[model samples]
Target chain A: MKTVIIKYNAGNVSSVSFALERIGINALISENAEEIKSADKIIFPGVGEAGSAMNYLRQNKLDEVIHSLTQPILGICLGMQLMCNYSEEGKTNCLGIFDQNVKLFPLSELKVPQVGWNTITDLKTNLFSGIIENEYQYLVHSYYVELSAYTIAQTNYGISFSSALNKNNFYGVQFHPERSGAAGQKILENFIKL
Target chain B: MLSKRIISCLDIKDGRTVKGVNFENIIDAGDPVELAIAYAQQGIDELVFLDITASNEKRKILVDLVSRISRQVNIPFTVGGGISSVEDVSVLLNSGADKVSINSAAVKDPGLLKKMAGQFGSQCIVVAIDTKFENNDWWVYINGGQINTGIKAVDWAKKITELGAGEILLTSMNNDGTKKGFAVNITKQISEAVNIPVIASGGAGTMQHFKEIFISGKADAALAASIFHYKEIEVLELKKYLKNNNLEIRI
Candidate 1:
């Protein structure tokens, strides 16, 4: 099967590419509409601010192309946030694929950016096919999509929020599966099988 | 809940892994690529490679080393030492480093942080601050902890975050290689001061030190060198201990 990683001005693409390679898949990194649309599965991976990333997607018309992709598409980290309707970071207007708004973690006595690895629970989708319910997944996010009907998994950090979301062919994960251990790799493998 | 991260730092000089105290007393550890792969398998949350060599010849060797390590491991890696410009950051990231850390160059030119953040995005730019306790205050140091900037650590952290740095890797020079414990007070001060993630480095002698850094320092991640290099504390074992202590950790 063919996989393409939507490339824009963001970080973490190389790690994702290397992960796919480990699974015996040679994924293409491309921003071209034709190349991304032709792939059997597409992975959107990013690590950056919301507004600027959204701007790049819109500027290149990748935003519309991504929304229309019929094949399974997985969004990672900031990629997942941008797949939502809007973001509080830089007041970003995203692709509106998931019908949710990404909001910044409220300033409290606790830390703002929830970094490192965190366990995910209440998984209710095929994404957790072979994975345990409360297994750990790596995450580094400042803004999060609030829990909605589409949320498949939830993670707690000062407050519990959506860790995984699914809406038809589009799937979004707030954690970095490429960096998370075996459980994370399983999630990606499931997504690939889908 | 977020599990605290345990990271091992490897100082690379002439394509080999080296460890020391306060950037002195250097000792050979192993090959950089081999050590990185070993740590990844041990469940290290992240890995950092600091290119300690200053010669122009070693620069090429470091790039090749980064490429090799990126192909071997799936975890995030950050590279530092002698990063001066946006091109430097781009070259490293292109070679497979998830993030490029700026230290002496960033302090010399504060605008470099903002510029790099704009060009490559904040998540790819890490600002490493080495601090030493002086006159009852934490002062930022540069030149591999050889020169003190005379700037307060807290103030500099706030400024860098405002300038759009994604994360801060704070190293306590006085505590480095001492293995007593993390400079908890300094880490707590900086973690409270910035909105970004603070990685506490130095003074990590035992697994309990990791617990202390997470609980008392409130740091998002703890980075150590000697303990991990010497196999004193395995990353998986450390995470298990933290989980038992009521601290969230990925197992």
Candidate 2:
């Protein structure tokens, strides 16, 4: 199966490719619209500001290619945030795949960007197959998608939020499945099998 | 709920692990990649590779090592030591390092932190601060704790946070290498001062110390080097102990 990782100006594409490699899949990292459109699976990975990322996608015409893709697509971290309708970060608009809005966590006792490992609960969809409920996943982000109908998994950090989202062929996870240990690897494996 | 992180630090020199690691299953303890995989298998939440190599070719070697570790290990790791400029951070992060920690360089030119945080988001930029308690205050130290900057640790932590640091890896010079325990007082103070996560380093001797740093120290994570290198406390056992103690630890 041909798996292509959508690489724009975002970070963490190499790490995601390596994770796919560990799972025995040599995924291609590409920004070319034709290359990404022709893949069996596409993984959208990002770890940078939303506005700039969106600008890069638009400038390279990747935004149109991504919105028109019909294959199983997975978005991780900032990529997941950009999958929503809008993001509070940089007041940028994103792909309307999930119809969710990304908002920053309110300043409180808990840290802004909830770094380190956090548990994902209420697991649903094939993306979490072979993964247990409340399994730990590594995450690093300041903004989060509020709990919505598309939320496949939930995690609490001041409030309940969508740790993983699924709508049709599109899958998005706020955590880094590539960086998450064995359970995370399993999620990636399941995504591939899907 | 977010679980407290347990990180293992490996000192790298010329692309090799400095402190000899003796894991029973490890074939080449000198190899940082092998050692990193071992630690990840033992359920280590994160790993930090402090590259202490001072050669002109250090960047190339360090980047190669980072790429190797990223390919082999399926966990987040930070590459630090001798990273001063945006170019250094760019190569390391692009090479698959999850985060890059800046120590003395950040202190020398605080603008570097802002520039790094702006270029590469704050989440990927970790500011490592080494401090010592003197004159009834925890003062920031640089150059691997060889020079005291005379700035208060708490003040510096708050400054860095405002300057766009995603996390603070606070190491207590007094507590480091002591193995007695972490400096809970200063750790709590700094953790409270900053809005970001504080990774308390130094003075972690026992599993109880880990529990203390989380409970009393309010440290979001705890880092130790020698004790883990010496095999005095295993990562899995320590996590189980912390879990039993009612800490939100990933086991």
The most accurate candidate by lDDT is 2
Candidate 1 chain A least-lDDT 10 residues: A107-116
Task: For candidate 2, list the clashing residue pairs, or say none.
Answer: B181-B203
- Candidate 2 runs further than 4 Å off: none
Provide per-model DockQ scores.
Answer: 0.53, 0.88
In order, the Cα lDDT scores of the candidates are: 0.86, 0.93
User: Tens digits of per-residue lDDT for model 1 on B14-54?
Assistant: 88777642221223336777677667777888899999998
Cα displacement (angstroms), candidate 2, residue A65, comes to 0.5
RMSD of each candidate relative to the true structure: 3.4, 0.8
- Model 2, residue A181: distance off in Å is 1.1
TM-score of each: 0.92, 0.99
| Candidate 1: segments with Cα more than 4 A from true spot | B19-29
